[model samples]
Target: MRRAAPLALLAALGAAPLAAQDSAPCGGDFGTFLQGVEAEAVASGIDPATASAFVAGLGPDPEVIAADRRQGVFQLDFLTFSRRLISQDRIDRGRAMADRHATTFDRIEAEYGVPRGVLLAFWAFETDYGAVQGDFGTLDALATLAHDCRRPELFRPQLVAAAELFAMGEIDHATTGAWAGEIGQVQMLPADILENGRDGDGDGRIDLKGSAPDALMSGGAMLQALGWRADEPWLVEVTVPDGLDWASTGLNHPRPVANWAAAGVAARDGALPGGGPGTGLEARLLLPQGRNGPAFLAYPNFDVYFEWNQSFVYVTTAAYFATRLMGAPIYLAGDPDPGLSGEQMIALQEKLVARGHDVGGVDGILGERTREAVQVEQQRLGLPADAWPTPALLGAL
Candidate 1:
């Protein structure tokens, strides 16, 4: 299940009309919010001149809020999401990038243990290989999100980090980024950039926006922090035999390759997905669509994908597409059981939340949390623990 946290953060700031209404500090004025932020910045040891100059006249971005409410990616199924994001054109562009930056990629891979194909796939997904990174200023976007009532708690730290970067003269005040304050083609937040950003181009500075090498290298550093294993495959498509313990599926339950092999698990194709099979790798089964869809066993490095994005579809597709870029065949199979309609999913979420299972949200999106909740519900009802939501569940509820 993909967590839409980053997207959830920045979905609402846009070039919307600035509000005409004005109010006192801490009431409702955007100016007041900016002033408060500046005061806080000065107290935090940021240069008073920089703080005052930075927040002056920053307006409330109403359009960003509008965009936030209209997010439909979370509502999309894996098949639809994959089809929309992992297009042939994107693959082609990725391949071209890989070829063009072969030297840089080879060097980064040799140094960081991250493959070129993986970086290319992520680059293609993040900003279409540096083609369309958003135009929102980082400070403005973070500030706007921090002030928004929906998720102020989440964006507040990011806003502070952006300010710090500005204060240090690391990120220019005019630096543009995605709505969520993600800078460069990789769409990383200010903190992540400050912490993991690298001088990939070796030009004495880190410029992720202009330097693909920097983004890719910095991204590899971030993955290393998340426990990505160079020796292990992130995930591998696999087949699960009938009569298996359905509850054992998902990322939380990993087992040795021998354990899964003993239980009749095997690769979808003839060979191990990435590395050789004799490596004694451990894996957790990931049935994105319950027991009736494309299943894979996630390895250690798989955790790094979640670090990149909470969305299973987005992360998995990036990993999956990376393999495709390296000449591996795509998963051409269909789900044995389809996903639920939006209304059905919404109903299911409401029922699960009412029961205190923590489905995460009642927003109709079936993610890992919701699926796990469904599994618990199924177990309680003495049904199969495939972790799928169905019409049968609705009636049971």
Candidate 2:
């Protein structure tokens, strides 16, 4: 799957490209910032009235800034995080929803090649199937983030896109959602709605909040646009043999299924998918925690999950939950070694950064890039190379 960065997302949507703003001022006078945002929205084809109204009384939201800063929940290990999220209640509800919207899901599969479980996983996680979309004022959240200077380059265009959406009457000042300015049941950014939103119920306008069909269809379409392959598996549980070359695992190393099978990697249940007839399918041996924890073979379709969300644990759990909803059995959680605490992780990241490795912001999350760096250092130190950092590795470094 192609990973669409912010600029790539704009290009794919045919939205007006934002000029480089690395040197642009942020957190200045709110009025002055709104003037520039309004001008950009107008240049991007939003009516001047709409843009002006969108930013007329907007002010920085302290709550939004706090939410952005306090994402410590993401620091949890995969097993703990997934255990909290993948409850029996959610699994049951997801299956019931799939049965309720069987026809719509079938149609989405036919049209977009995205399965019901994929959309349902996101729906269940994002807002509990639309039951609990946030209450932050959408425009206020966007404007606040756009002017906050922490991530102006990312949020500024989203604000303009929200303005354009307002002009199209898709959203209004009364619209509310996630603190990060994602709107509706699936919690989509404005650019995402403008780019991939679909009206599955044929109501003409896309209403993701009130319309389950619209949200599901729109989510499916977005996944398709993100390069979901038709009829491909995303993730499958597997058991890796002892003494396997752990350094050859992770998403960075995608070996053929035949190679993995030959290496004694067996599926937990049923026959493994062999990419039927002439398609050389490849998969990454993913050990989210360590060699001793639950393992999975992540396929190409799995990569699209990252495009949906950056958190490795969240994406893996979401993808695994999708599989469970599809009748897959529960995973086997082996006794993995205990992981480092948040502070230890920060110290490890500092050491890695000093050694010229980019762990992608060093926020103490074991993200993919961080895992890759860990594996490289593990191999260098003659450790297990499972990419699960421990106190020993930290002390050794």
Candidate 3:
């Protein structure tokens, strides 16, 4: 799910008032909690009447809490997640949307340095090109999460920002969106909308839900604000030679393109982009499913994907799908070694935690910290440090 822009950036955008609040006790009467939220919102510059009406009759949304607790879908492996999302229908529709909004796309690229594929890929994944933004009430979801004590510090400020949006007449208590409170076609949180939203349609109002240009442009602006390099390649499919040192392969180990090229990493279709000699572009070798599976050279631009979403599977899929939308050929999915099941992953994480390795949580998801710990364990076990957990690795541990 989407979060607000990074706190540093949010502060630069004058969002300090909302972020400065200390965490209060959670899990009490919903009405009393909302009263405090409303008072806090007004203190954070929300109009009094707006804050009152925004929280009027608001209660903790049980549906939001239930949805928050049910996120096992992220446990799917990279191939499974990418295959489920990057459908032929999505590709065709994405191209159609790009062509339909050529002028807006051109303007966004010229102004924000973000291509149509990047925006369209996110638009497709987020809401199927604005087809199915979530149905949860945005205000209720934010307020509920704010008072739920699970991640109150994160969601409480978002609730205040949504109240500020309500004050601006941008959204209302009935605004429906993702269960995490991300709204509109591109699924942005309220603070992000407030900071980076644009009126691309020239109607003087940023209507991300009703207007395609508005949503696409606002997404482009957000990416630019998140540090997208102009006219840079984010991900490139590549063929890796055997006997390569697998320990140095991951998003954490970025090497110069020339160095990687000299080491025998070749682009699948064309010559490796070495940033034209001495430009010093770097890339990290990424093997999402291990050395034998689909491989990529994820460049610096690809790092911006994490700022958009934290799920490695989702970000990699979105980056690769952006390449697909830009006319890259379908990737060759090679025979990869079997990965751990969700239960096995959880067990492995528990073991890692016992051994003083922080896997970020014992959730089934193979996040970056988990991957780092896995690589270390694989190295200690004299296995290939491809960072992909397998049955053998688990048995050894």
Candidate 4:
């Protein structure tokens, strides 16, 4: 899921105006919200005890909302984020954890057909391998988000699912430990916990808090359900030939490897991996830092990484971390330009919009659509079509 924006954090804290009210009308009291929620739970067939226990102390939590807002600023750059999250210390810790819980990870990989490294990588990323599950009350966070107006439509159902968890005795109101009501070491949402979590430890309880086996196994199970191919790579860094037609490479428009080779696109070492000719997998050419930076051929499984975290940088970092875990070399190329500011990006978007070009939503985030729009404008202006955002581009705009 995308990290909660600043506005989302404010709304979750009940600092923003209610969606139902136009001009800061009287807000719904906690008592009133709980009463309505209790009624809904009972009508939804939940027992009274479960409903009361779940809703008794639920309210807006300022600290959690603050944390959510702060998360947006924590990882400003991909390299910094990767260095912190996938540090040598982290890798050593993960390897030790994997060794200690070899039986659990082995069984999980065998059953789910997910690589142990990938599962371990996710475990390390989600909660620092259980070393730092958030200390805030999970119920409070869920209740705050559910009662808040900005994304009540998205979080209210999660609130309902949390109540169901309580009703089923899967978890009590006291044991949950996620930022947004996600439970367990893997930080799984309530619905995912209900659907995919497993008792790998076989202790007659699905304990995610204290059981490494359960958490790792549950994570592998979720990935399996998402169609993780056991032997296929998620993505690979490749060399794109000069003068290659980037428009031909899109997510929906796939061509065979042979066809791509015919078009002068070849693997970096002049040898394609053993996926056979014309595997029919669609791919896209990704130039994260324009024409001078390292390139990648992303496949469908790359999209699956986005399901975990929507940010392109997040997915790319995960893929890179996976490569590191597999003993692959780090990316040797540097980003062409990393100093672009949010204001400059916004200015560029405004200029594009003024020119009657759609750059998608102008949130100052340079996504693929924004990059493509910038490239089109650059081509129209007789500039280089590298699709990179720079201060010079902003000046031209």
- The global C-alpha lDDT for each of the candidates, from Candidate 1 onward, is 0.72, 0.83, 0.84, 0.66
List pairs with backbone clashes in candidate 1: 2-310, 2-311, 2-312, 3-310, 3-311, 11-68, 12-64, 12-65, 13-64, 14-64
Instruction: Give the winner by lDDT.
Output: 3
Q: What TM-score, to 2 decimals, does candidate 1 have? A: 0.88
- Report residue 223 deviation for candidate 1 (angstroms): 2.0
lDDT by residue for model 2 over 72-159, one digit each (tens)?
5567788887787788988999999999999889999999999888988888888888887788888998998889876887888888
Candidate 2: where is the Cα deviation over 4 Å? 1-25, 275-277
Models ranked on lDDT:
3, 2, 1, 4
Residue range 162-244, candidate 4, lDDT tens digits: 78888988866576576667676777777777788899899988888789888888888888887776666665667767787
Whole-model lDDT, model 3:
0.84
**Residue pairs in collision within model 3:** none
Per-model TM-score versus the true fold: 0.88, 0.92, 0.92, 0.84
lDDT of 3 by residue, 263-328 (tens): 888999898776358878999999999998999999989989999988787789889999999999
Candidate 1: count of backbone clashes, pairs at least 3 residues apart or interchain: 10
Error of 2 at 176 (Å): 0.5
